[model samples]
Target: MQLSVLDQSVAVTGRTEDASIRETLTLARHCEALGYRRFWVSEHHSHPTIVGSAPEVLMAAIAATTSRIRVGSAGVMLPHYAALKVAEQFRVLEAIAPGRIDLGVGRAPGSDMRTARLLSSDPRQSADNFPIQVRELQAWLAGVDLPEGHPGRGVTANPMGPSAPEMWMLGSSDYGAQLAAHYGLPYAFAYFITDGQGAGQALDLYRANYRPSPRHPAPQAVLCVWALAADTEAEAWHHFSGRERWKIDRNRGALAALPSPEEVALRPYTPAEQMEADKLRANAFVGSGPQVAAKLRALANTLEVEELVVITWAHDPAARRRSYELLAREFF
Candidate 1:
């Protein structure tokens, strides 16, 4: 199975955004050397823990820093910007690294409603126009004309060449699966965020209804999940404690930098919080290299996906890197 990474450039309790970005670049290079297929960064706006607000800029930086690994967004929230602009930005990236660039688009806001309004021209629109946006983006990227009488019919996203960046639709629901199937694009399921709920159904729907397009002739699906590995099961649990605490805090509407294991150990938690954490933990894979490897392989086999994109968070940058290193050694 192929393995990839989806890094949020998470800011730890004691680290600055600059430090977080540096760690992202370092991790990209490390994963590339370790033979990862792709290294994708996330986009979040006004989030205390996440530092990746602009995936296009970060993708360019990662592409310049790494030689072999494909770099892209995990993805860019499409509703926030014009499709033509998004296409242009990624086209420039394609020029920078050609086939190494990917344009993963999603419909979510990637932030709270308040921040969403700030980014979007009309935040109150109840009906989602993401299907229309995707069509425009695809047209611009392919340098093809939109349907006659369309507002974007005459517009062209410049820098178009013989090849465009690969596009993948990212979603956690059946709606996204159906949309991707209709468009004949590759689909990536956010299993970590959805806690593995409805994933089987979503993938099944995508495969059953998928139409062949020039970009993706066959159904290609990727599963993204939270994972961590350590030398021992106990140490891996220690790394996961912070993630558990972070999830609890996030559910309570309290966002903060990723706490350290020591900090998590010292915090007092209610029974409900503990239950929530346990539930989240059940969806995550944390153990020794072989243990995590076995679980990941089983999951991939069950999902029938050839690629797995892992998202790991820890207070220590070294620990995060080590986790990927161990997993790569075990699987790759």
Candidate 2:
């Protein structure tokens, strides 16, 4: 099916529980043992909900622990940082993990407008420059000579850096699709971010306008989705019940610890919250091995996605770990 499973690092925790960095490292190492194709750490600045704000730092830890699995950002919100610096850091990571590193960049600053403005002071950078940054980073990794007027010409990256980690354009919108087409790198669509809109139009735009380059002749696509599997459908849904409630509360300016499955079930919820929860879970695939496999397969055909990255959030860390293990056993 040309399908590969993927997971996001959320630092799984209970309502009042804390997930230690040590525990996260262990979880990631366990995934490597479980044989996932790639483990992607998302980038978010100063979020109490997630522990992976610095993807490179976490990559260093993960790279040290595993040998076969590819590790990189599901996206490292590129607009927030310098391309050369990102290139250098990933080059170092590539030095350690070699062919196993992947770089997926997103245009979003990953926060509210106020916070985005604080992080990305320049108002001029929109989706237009994302392609340029990806190209610039690729050149930096390839050791291609920079343009004479380019400010980064003076800086040098690692001599031992592996062939630049495979680059990917990530987005939930058409702008990212166009950028991916222009650059000819693999493109990933976050179905989780799209809120149930059909990505077909955007994917069509990407394939139609795709320009072939030596680096990538065929366009590659990944559908990023929220998924979970346990011994039973009820257990899987219950396992994810806390994160589900957490998401329901996140919009109300509440970032409190996630409630446990039992607590969320017992707790009262507004009608509005219930509606949103239904929509979120509508995209979420939670069930047993056979059921999850069937849902994922159908999603793959419906999206025509070359790869499937299962980005999950579960209430319990152990349950989250088991989810990966289950996927590995069924699909890997």
Candidate 3:
């Protein structure tokens, strides 16, 4: 079982008015040393909670710092960027990192509708054009032939990779499945979101309708689970509790310093709030090493995914690193 580790570089702090931007590049080295398979960052805009606004830029930094582990964006919101530009940007990164880049693409803005509109107001070519955008990116990456002397011909694309970045379809819906099959690309489902559908049902749909392409014939699947681990189940929950508060507050439109896991479990919640937390966070894995391992194992058992991708965050840097280390020891 490959334990794929990834982070979104959320704001982590206990007291600062604003979460300082901690350099996760150094942390990526630790992740590599700890034997994580990948270190992926996510892109978000105008959010107080996350600091990963430019994931490709961050991935390049991490790639330069570490020689082995795969690095990439959990996904770049494709609708807001040009396929040609993204192809060029990643091709350049691939030139540096070579075999280490993984390009996960998504259609989400990672923000609300107002922000989404502000990011890309072009009505003619925006979110609704996801399929076209993906196809364009695929063509650009594969270096598909263009009309003679076409401007698109000079894109200098490389579809396959040692240095070439592998492409992944990321989504919370069946929409991603269709695109992955159509492009014959590997698909990574956000278990964080699809828990509403049950992993088996979505995984079943993805596998059954998959089309074999030169890039992927086996219908590769990845499941994303939130994880936190510690020495003892109690200690793990203790550590995870604070982070849960971070989530709870974020969901409730309240924002402040990141919470320690211990803070979450030790704190009291109203009955309504506790139920809300449970419903909102049913997909997350928060416990001691063994406890987290069991939760992850059950998710894998149910999803039967090809890879288990852990998507987690912390408010405190030390706690964050320890959490990942504990998870690696038990689950990886």
Candidate 4:
């Protein structure tokens, strides 16, 4: 199995949010050294917990700093921006790193409707035109002629080079799967987003309906999963305490930065909250390196995917790095 990374530049308590961005860059370089396949960042706008609002900018930085690992967005929210502009931005990135860019696009608004409206040229613009946008974005990225009667028939996204960014359709639902299948693009299911719900169905739909393209003759699928690993199972669970508390609090409308595990240990959970926490813990991939790696292998095999993009969060950036290091030791 090929293990990749999806770093969201998570903000931790008592640290500046900008620090999270820097940490993401540092982690990308670290992952590259550890022999990971790709280092993908996420796009989330006006989000308190997730600060990676600009994935294209961050991808450029990562592409400049890392020589081998593939760099991409997981992904750029298509409805928020013009396809031509996104194509141009990624074209510039391809110019920077050549064959290492992956342009993952999605239909969902990465933020609240107010922020989505602010991001759009038309405040009323919804995701209804996502398919059209993806078609145009793909054409522009590859410097192909737009179809007849298209508004961008003659325009080209320039600095067109020897290579173009590989496109991947990303989602937590079947909509992205079907769209990706229709376009013959790679599909990545956000297993971490829905905590594995609907993942099997989405992947099955993608493979069953896939239309072969020149770039991809066969269906390609990826799972973006959340996992953490440490020296021991107990230690791993301790490190996961912060994310667990954050998840529960997030459900209760508290979007605070990740608290330290030490701080989490002191808080008391109600019976219902404790049950919820237990459910999350049971579902989580937290343990020693071998234990977590075993689960990762099982999940990849069960999902019938060769690539698993691991995304980990911890109050301490060191712990996050260690998590990746441990997994790399097992898988790489």
Q: Against the true structure, what is each candidate's TM-score?
A: 0.96, 0.90, 0.88, 0.99
Query: What TM value does model 2 have?
Result: 0.90
Q: Write the per-residue lDDT of candidate 1 for residues 6-77, one digit (tens) a residue.
A: 999998887677899989999999999999999999999999999799999989999987788999898999
Q: Give candidate 4's error at residue 208 in angstroms.
A: 0.4
* Stretches of candidate 2 exceeding 4 Å from the true structure: 2-20, 117-128
The digit string of per-residue lDDT tens for model 2 on 85-104 reads 88888888888888988888
Least well predicted 10-residue stretch by lDDT in candidate 3:
14-23
Least accurate stretch of 10 residues (summed lDDT) in model 2?
Answer: 11-20
Choose the strongest candidate by TM-score. 4
lDDT of each: 0.91, 0.76, 0.75, 0.94
Order the candidates by lDDT, highest first — what do you get? 4, 1, 2, 3
* Candidate 3 residue 127 C-alpha distance from true site, Å: 1.4
Candidate 4 lDDT, 205-289, residue by residue in tens: 9999999999999999999999999988998999999999999999999898889998997998999899999999989999999
**What lDDT does model 3 reach?**
0.75
- Model 1: worst 10 consecutive residues (lDDT sum): 120-129
Against the hidden true structure, what lDDT does model 4 obtain? Answer: 0.94
Candidate 1 deviant stretches above 4 angstroms: 122-127
* RMSD values, in order shown: 1.4, 2.6, 3.0, 0.8
lDDT of 3 at 180: 84
lDDT of 4 at 231: 89
